[model samples]
Target: MPVQPTPGTPPQATSRQQADSAQRVELGATIRRLRKERGLTLVQLAQRSDLSHPFLSQLERGLTHPSMPSLHRIARALGTTQQALLASAVRADPDVTRQAIRVVRCGEGLGVPNVGGMARMLGSPQLGVHPVEYRGAQTDFGDYFDHPGDEFLYVVDGEVEVDLLTADGRVVHQLAAGDSLSYLGGTPHRWRALGDSDRFRLLAVQNATDPLTGTAEPHG
Candidate 1:
């Protein structure tokens, strides 16, 4: 009797190929994250690489396929060679499904919590942030300074003063929730929880390397 492949079971070769396809998604995400982290907008990247803005946006959004030359150009602009991207893509585990992301409490997981002490991990670990809580007045907020990315704030509850700093130690802007601010990330920054109330709550979303990315605060 001739043997037939099981209806539910994929052949080893087919499985291996599928795994490769999955890695493509991860590679695409990495590309987008790196691009955003560099604070280079699609328009800027296009200008730098001489690529069309639409095409570049599609590539970053993972909606289109980028040719080797195009990828190479983008890589050059990002200051990383194509080989590094390729290596990362290759090292990605095929078993890891990109769509099955889980939302965990900031302090619970090995991730930075955003505002309200809650971090919603969108789809990938690379795509989310949680609320960060700053306690005490005049607190230095160690490890809580300017970082290499942009960040957004949403005041969940309570009150706090968020101060941004420039190279010259000047306060550029200040805000309290119900109030929000967006600024170039990674530039020395600080915040203080204000109000005579017992709780000070705020949500901060910055580049994944914001150091605070892995930490979470409790919502009052």
Candidate 2:
């Protein structure tokens, strides 16, 4: 005799399990993509990350469960930070792709207020690429207002008073024209304008979180 389960329960349970398995598969695929992107073979990754062949194979095939530490090893072998890999995974997963990012402004000689100074994205959407902008600093204060993502700034004009907040807290930096700065986005940073110059311009690059990636990152 067969015992029927409650209505909708069985299907829901199956869906959950399937979703979990799919994510595992995507994680494996992401690892492999990164590996190939870095020109590393399975054996090379095994040696570099201190993982095993059959185990890694199983992971790549999404046929087994891997601990966080194990995944981290694979991540390191691929030469990319783990957070970026995880972010890729989230982006690849349809389950987490509900948000929409529409283009805002697109024109010449126009700038919008970003986390810091004005950001110019007055081109095609592809020019926007990842969610970031070219920011400028004025009056010694920096254009960064402390957000998330790793960042770099190449000074195109003027001097800057760059303040950075890292894992250890706040530290101020004096950046003159042409000085480059790179740091984590999660680090709180505020820049004050400096010298006789009224503003500073820099090409700011950062990989920002989509709404879904937000759950994993901290709120500033």
Candidate 3:
């Protein structure tokens, strides 16, 4: 037997369900904004991602959610990464003062899902720098990320390998704990955790604007 609601009582959503609904709406808005930034229509994006236009439309309308593979395809089509898309959907502090000077306590920040590891945003985008802390288990060669402005990475623990795709060929660099690296923007690069422990922590910082001209660039 099941319980039924009273005639005048309205159905209510759980907190988790409400959060999911909000995230869905934010993600849809992000996708639509990115598509418009690239000057792409729904049909064009569908063709680029090999997904159906109707499905893309539904996704943008927040009526549907995309699977991991579908999301990867969409991210690739948008010249970004799945992590970037997820991070963009995360709700930041609405208060301007909070955004200006905020401190993220341990284990407290915006979490990004399904990026082959655990990642959290430690800084707000309003500060002109996006800082994310990544904890990885096992060696996972994630997708390459390329965006405007400069990027910096610091190894907080364990070891990792970074590959930079250059005009001539791929350049690989092995880094241990306390090691750091910096590179110009628009350079394709990817990284993976290493070592027998199969665990590592990395801090990645990227400029939110062009370093040379101080112009805003695409997030993530």
Please give the CA lDDT of all the candidate structures. Answer: 0.50, 0.54, 0.69
Candidate 2 lDDT trough over 10 residues, lowest sum: 121-130
- Give the clash count for each candidate: 19, 13, 0
Error of 2 at 35 (Å): 1.1
Candidate maximizing TM-score: 3
Off by over 4 Å in 1: 1-97, 105-124, 128-144, 167-169, 172-174, 196-198, 209-220
lDDT of 1 by residue, 1-220 (tens): 1124457775764554454444455557767777788898888988998999988766555455554346556766776533334334432453325653444333221111222232222223333332233322342343244334456776666666666566767664445557777777455566655564336555555443322232322222
**Candidate 1: deviation at residue 16, Å?**
34
TM-score of each: 0.38, 0.43, 0.66
Which digits, one per residue and each the tens of the lDDT, describe model 2 over residues 1-220? 1124457777755554554456557667877776776788989889997989889888787667665345546655664433344435434334342333333333321233433355443222122223333454345443334434566766767777778867787788877767888887567666655654436565656554432232223333
Q: Candidate 2, TM-score vs. the true structure? A: 0.43
- Give the per-residue lDDT of model 3 (tens digit) for 1-220: 1224456554442333444455566777888988998899999999999999999998887677665457768877887655455545545333225436666657555455435566666664446676878887347676776766578999999998999987878899999999999988778988877774346888988776532233556543
Candidate 2 residue runs with Cα over 4 Å from true position: 1-9, 98-220
Model 3: how far residue 187 lies from native, Å:
1.6
Local error of candidate 1 at 61, Å? 36
Best by lDDT: 3
